[model samples]
Target: MVFDFTISKQGNYAIISMNGNLIEKGQAIALLEKAEELTKEGCSQWIIDLEKLIYMNSSGLNTLIQLLTKARVAGGEAVLFNMNKKINELILITKLHTLFKVAGSKSEAVEILGL
Candidate 1:
């Protein structure tokens, strides 16, 4: 499937729902740009919903790390939720699970971000 994403606001956080395959940094440029815009708007906290993501490669992982860095630089945080089994395993294998805050649901992600 082709990569796509939607951005929405929830409280003080931005919810980024990703869909389809994510294997290239170019595909995430829009996402990163939107994140930067939101950060400037003082809505830096993020919840990345991966439930619809069909596949992800190393570049996808890098994109996530970039998001986390952006949030932190903005004095906020990013949480991930609704990850599929394969994605979860990839995170664990890469030891990124420790680098990221993950939740089982959107509500939980909001709680993690304290929003």
Candidate 2:
């Protein structure tokens, strides 16, 4: 599937829902740009929903890292939720699980963000 994403807001958090294959950084430029815009608007805490994402490569990992960095630089945090088995394994394999806050559901992600 082609890569697509949606951004929404809940309280002070920005929720980013990703879908389809994420294999290239170029596909995520818009996402990063919008995240930057949201950060400037005071919505820094982020929840990345990956349940719809069917596949991802190293570039996808890079995108998540970028988002996490942006949130932290804004004095906020990012949590990932609803990841599939493949995606979850990739994160673990890369040791990125140690760098990211993960939750099993959106509510849990929000709780992790303390919102």
Candidate 3:
């Protein structure tokens, strides 16, 4: 599938449904920018739903870190849900699984934020 992403909301959380491949800086920047913009608009929770993300690269990891930083500085946090095994493995390999709050579903992620 062609690269695509859609944004949805659950209460105060912004859920990004990512698809296709994320291999370049532009993709990374776009995703990061959206999260940052939402944070500036007072979104207190961010959820990245990776159930559909087929592939990702280092830039995608960079984007995630950027959002995590912003979320923490804003007194909020980015949660991840429905991560594919491949994607999950990447986090583990990088030892970043500890940095993220992983949940089984959108509701679970929202609950983690106490929303």
Candidate 2 backbone collisions, by pair:
none
- Candidate 3 residue-wise lDDT, 1-115, digit = tens: 5667888876677887888887777766666777778888888588888888888878878777888888899889888889888999999999888998988898898888888
lDDT of 2 by residue, 27-94 (tens): 99999999999999999999999999999999999999999999999999999999999999999999
Q: After superposition, how far is residue 57 of candidate 3 from its true place, in Å?
A: 1.8
Lowest lDDT sum, 10 consecutive residues, model 2, at 7-16
Q: Is candidate 2 or candidate 3 better by lDDT?
A: 2
lDDT of each: 0.94, 0.95, 0.82
Q: Where is model 2 more than 4 Å wrong at Cα?
A: none
Residue 66 lDDT (model 1) = 97
Clash count in backbone of candidate 2: 0
- Candidate 1, position 54, lDDT: 87
TM-score of model 3 vs. true structure: 0.90
Question: If scored against the real structure, what TM-score would every candidate get?
Answer: 0.98, 0.98, 0.90
User: Clashing pairs in model 3?
Assistant: none
